[model samples]
Target: MSPVSSFLWTYAVGVKVLLSQLLSRSFSLPVFPLQNGKVAIVTGGAKGIGYETAKHLSRLGMHVIIAGNHENQGELSVSRIVKETGNEKVEFMYLELASMQSIQQFVQHFKAKNLLLHVLVNNGYIRWPVNQCSPGAAAVMLVPQRNTADGFEEHFGVNYLGHFMLTHLLLDTLKQSGSHDLNSRIVTVSSATHYIGELNLNDLQSRHNYSPHGAYAQSKLALVLFSYQLQQRLAAEGSHVTSNVVDPGVVNTDLYKHTSWLFKLCKWLTSWLLFKTSTQGASTVIYAAVSPDLEGAGGSYYVNGQKVKSADISYDEDLQRKLWAQSCNLVGNPERHQCAS
Candidate 1:
């Protein structure tokens, strides 16, 4: 899209989000009993909504692993959470979503601990700028494309594919840890932008006509489809595991670090009336993670603390299967039984 078109499109989306934020009241998460001994892995837990979710889970007495690429930040966040929550079980683990090798090592390290896995929160993401230009500048100066360590589109790879591989690698442990009464859960962080997503199955890597907006949306939409598809498989197999997607309302976080100057200006002017804080945005994640109310419920798309329908295309069963199969090939799911470095 041209710079003018991109600006208009972004403005429209931003307006819609701000209007929704104004209309919707804060959702109060229902308090749940302490989840003693249960384990959870929250990717990108060192900051923003992920950090808040990890801290909340830790407060509930659950063993929380803050998985990310930044070792220093991860360790410090873990220490902070431990100190604040008084939960020594809170710790950090190295997991670089951009690299499958790092993901494998993360899983191996977790498995070596022989701990039970109750929740997996796929919450990390990066938003590259789409070259927001001035009125006097060219209308269509394409931002240089970004790729992951595996050569996939940056957004598609780190945000969606990384979590897909991680979930599959840990699926067995999640199943074994869950029971009929208290089912295991997988909560993926999706976005309202998913409604605008357009996925080209043939070009899952976004090798052509790449735009950060489209790439990010496509990745989030993929997560919704993956979550629903995984939910279906878990139910069909009678596994005591559930998979769900959560659209944390547009929260004030570094997720928007790549926004254009104008957008950032709007944010500063609004002073958070137009956006939810990270703590507020994490409500649905915590709700989906441990709420007994959601036990046994799978494939639910949660927003504003209520279950809602996702994008119309997300329900395409055939598309879901195709994406799943393609993702498996991309992530080497066929070799999941044995750890491959």
Candidate 2:
């Protein structure tokens, strides 16, 4: 997209987000008073909106487990939340989404705890410089082609595939929890950038053509697609575990740490003018996880605690199905084993 076009599109989306927040301000988020027995796992809960999300969920009296790669930061986050919320159930578990082995290990450890999971928040992401190795490379060359330890594109692997595996691995527990209350949920944190992404099923990792923005957007789109598809499968199997996506509008977070100095300066200058606070950005996630109005509501996109229509492409069932099949294959689900309830 051209500079002017990009700017205008961003401005329009920002206005819409602000309006949504304004309209929903009077709607008080429901508090879960009987959440003492419930459990929630939030990925990337060490910092940014994820940290705030973990804090909020713990405040509701739920047993919250924060999974992230940073050991010290994760422990610190767990300590702070426990001190603030006085919910000692909050704990941190090590997880590196860039590696399949790490995701499996984390899931295995959680399962060994023998706790029923009421919510799974897939909220972690990374944004690296597309051409950090060759800073002077051309635009195409600047596209991030880096792969994860699993040999998948870094963004795709961490943002979409890893969560995909984690969710499937824990599906049984989520279903077991829902058997008692029918309110278990899987909340996938997506972004408005999904609208700008072009899903190339043939080249999901972007081996042939790549752009940093395109790869990031594609990962988010894949997340939404997975959310919808998962919801559909759950419904078809007569399960009550709902799956939904959230867009935390333009928050100033560490996700942009890899940006250029010029971009950083510009963001600092416009931070208050454009960005949402981490707490504000996390509100939608909390809403999706516990909102009474959303009980059993699946396959929806939410912003600022309200159900909102997603990008045009997000409604394409064919695209959603294709992405789901490809994701299963990439994750080694060759037989397409139905996720156990």
Q: Model 2 off-target regions past 4 Å? A: 1-32, 126-143, 260-262, 334-336, 339-341
lDDT of 2 by residue, 238-280 (tens): 8869999999887777766544465568668877765678888
**Cand. 2 Cα-lDDT:** 0.78
Clashes of 2: 0
What does candidate 1's lDDT look like per residue over 1-341, in tens digits?
43345446656766797798889798898879999989999988888899999999999999999887666677888999999999999889888777899889999999999999999999854322224322121110122467767898877888889898899889999999999999999999988777777778998887776677777768878999888888888898899999999988878876555667887798888846878999999999999999988989989899889999889999999999898888988887634542221
* Best model number under lDDT: 1
Return the TM-score for candidate 2, rounded to 2 decimals: 0.87
Model 1 stretches astray by more than 4 angstroms: 1-7, 126-144, 334-341
What is the RMSD, in Å, between candidate 1 and the native fold over all Cα?
A: 5.4
Model 1: what TM-score? 0.91
Predictions in order: lDDT: 0.82, 0.78
- TM per prediction: 0.91, 0.87
